[model samples]
Target chain A: MTASVLSRPRPAVATPTAAKPRRRLGPGRAIPFGAAIGPVGLLTLWAVGSAAGWLDPRTLSAPWTVVTTAGDLIANGRLQDNLAVSAQRAGLGLAFGTVIGTVLALASGLSRWGEAILDGPIQIKRAIPAVALIPLLILWLGIGEEMKVLTITLGVLVPVYIHTHNGLRTIDSRYVELGESLRLPPGTFLRRIVLPGALPGFLLGMRFAVVGAWLSLVVVEQINSTSGIGYMMDLARQYGQTDVIIVGLVLYGLLGLISDGAVRLVQRKALSWRRTLAD
Target chain B: MATHAGGLTATRTVRVRSLSRGFGDRTVLNGLDLEIGEGEFVALLGRSGSGKSTLLRALAGLDRDVAGSGQIEVPQNSSVVFQDARLLPWQRILDNVTLGLRGPEAPQRGRAALAEVGLAGRERAWPNELSGGEQQRVALARALVSEPELLLADEPFGALDALTRLRMHHLLRELCTRHRPAVLLVTHDVDEAVTLADRVLLIDEGRIRVDLTIDLPAPRSHRQPQFLAYRESLLQSLGVYQTEG
Candidate 1:
């Protein structure tokens, strides 16, 4: 061999080319206060527009006026009272919807008989928008708390049922074999395999459920209501108190954002095992 | 139990008689009969759709889908190691090994089994944290944790790399020597059969085409004449799990 050939560096790494393993991206960390960037930018735009006389308070209230109005409402306790009522309504509806969705998902997901009995009707319910039922609900319940709460519950449950049922159906068949080979008891199998297998789907559904709750809440509370953030906004509409309407909108936005964040935090903790560590 | 020429009786741990399984119009296991003596190691070799996995599944009592009729006598205390580790990804390693095991000593037994597979301190790690070979080791630990009377493996090392498969063969031999469970390893590798099994059964057309006994020692060299002789003989059953047209 020539001296040049002998002196040539061997291939940089002598690793086998067969069976390429996926490169891990390593641990991921979100930037501090990254989520505030968009809202802050929007606030700055609104503040600048109102300060420069580009925005009319009649058309869209200035951001500072809305903030001041919020502070005034808090000082006089109107914000607190309406917020409490809104929170209570949302909380009750969320609990009822989540529980019903979970129970129905279990009933349909686990057995053929259960699926036959429950899946079709639930799927049909899923096809129809919850808001479309409001007129019928108003006729029956007379636009009371009953109608509003039920609307929220209906909106929240469909996504939960859909995602949970999908998760149950898609559990790996290999795990089922493993369960059988291990001879796991019914209780252990349900707790260890079935529940965990469906958890990701349940969490995914909750993400949609929270949004659904808020969307339905907005609709129901605006319809001749005496309480809630939506009611306050509607009341402001009558006298052109645009600042109070803006305040109500801000509260709704914050509530929706915070509730979603809360569910995401739970998801992170519950699914921490799914994150692959540095290899 | 059957007596040998030397007057030693062999206690059969498994006995399958006239088993026939079919899917639609095609039969996979047709009148298959087999027996495994106590503590004996057997390897089964076959092509794709040649009834190898069918036989293993039947013995594992996971043959609910296949239509079959036969008497299968398998011990209640049995464990299986599949090609994939099939470890629950959400569970820690120790919990995976100890799954379905009962009593107070279960955790301790799980630890010892993990230690036996040379994964002493990895009990808390997730299954995905380990390499493919290590995950297979965990599967082995899970299988042997219960001190089963019979161990059925369906290409347990088939998914590993060449080097990993070699290491696993040694680990399996060492574990088998210590635990002495009647093991039935199903694989497509002819060389693997000669290196591990006391007997290799070749199944074709849903029946035993050949039954070759390996008279070699533990950790048998693939290069040895006897080993190659065994491989050369069995290599006639070609196809890497290929299906018939």
Candidate 2:
């Protein structure tokens, strides 16, 4: 009976050949193609509308006209000058805001007294959007480079504080117990465990900060800036130079995408230890 | 009645005098007193919520927040292995073994301990990459690498499968014999207590109810009549009697 049971063949089931093989695109290979489809389709529609004379060139410039205008601005050094000014403002503001936010998060997350003092004020500031401070900032700092950088800094601070503080507070207590049992020194505990555990949240906040920097720059630069992409767009609006305006908007979108991509790359490298279904 | 083994010998590794602990009017460990000798293997058995874990935590000096005070003594160099392994996911296997250790030879010593636990050549693997049994082995290596004077294990093998638990039991026995640390294993399994412990204590209602010594020979077998008898008596003390004829 044992030999017969062992020798018995299994019943027919769904075989591998039953399912047809389909071509599926991996994410890495699909990205460029996926990214092209949206802008390319929109540009094609714009070009067709301009060619058929259904859209007036004064209201919405043709795709080719915007490209030629971008070329002209680059040759005259107008685009480069404004882009350089904006980049410096955004970079300096990001550095200052990130440092202050991280220090505040660590202080509050690690100590009761720090939280008791800092939490109430930070929450009050968070409730009031940074844009609401622009008029007050103009009254004080007077719409120079200082005012623009300060606006971006305020915009960057809120997300960094919220995400990083949440990360530090929510570290697994089991690991904390391990550290306690081993009697890890405070400095070593913070360096090895707490900081690395909070890095993902910090990077996520940075992505938000990058976008916020641009949003704040758009408003602050338009207010009274002598230079920047927003100033160029405002100049174009005065003379109805729609093509230059389109170029400025496109540059802003590209810069936002590039900065966010840099943060994501750093996040992937730092958190390579994590495993999830998406991987 | 309480039994006292009087004498302040240098070999006495643990000494607890009237230790009492409670949580918000709910008493967990009520005036419990116990002592353990050097290089001794003691198993604590209790039903769920009977204060076995609380007593073990007290002995490990990890119950600082609990109410009530008592004189509890333990060696300065001690380690604890929790039920969940608790290896840091961010660290490699070798780093986890040498966690909190500072010396020029610490990494080499960690490698040696991993080899002793049959986890050689897997130093660079992440904690999440290992199986449950392998993770527990890493925890054991981490605990033993420091050459602790007292090793407090809180249901360390409670999450393992039967076969893995059997293997771990043998491995733990071998390691304990070689290292000779005073071990206090808190477990709920009667057979596990009978198989591994030199002395078994049953805690009930926040106190030690039964304290019995197993005088069986080394390399004990469950097939032996003495082993079964100890298992039966200890099970009965825990209010579990076998209904088998």
Best by lDDT: 1
- Candidate 1, residue A137: the lDDT equals 95
Q: How many backbone clashes does candidate 2 have?
A: 0
Per-model lDDT: 0.90, 0.89
Ten residues in a row with the worst lDDT in model 1 chain A? Answer: A270-279
Instruction: Give the TM-score of each candidate.
Output: 0.89, 0.91
Q: Model 1, DockQ value?
A: 0.60
RMSD in angstroms, all models? Answer: 7.7, 7.1
Among residues 3 or more apart in sequence or in different chains, the pairs in candidate 1 whose N, CA or C atoms overlap within 3 Å are: none
lDDT of 1 by residue, A133-249 (tens): 999999999988999899999888899999998989899989998999999999889888998999989999999899788888889999869999899999999999999998988
> Candidate 2: how close is chain B to the reference, as a TM-score?
0.95
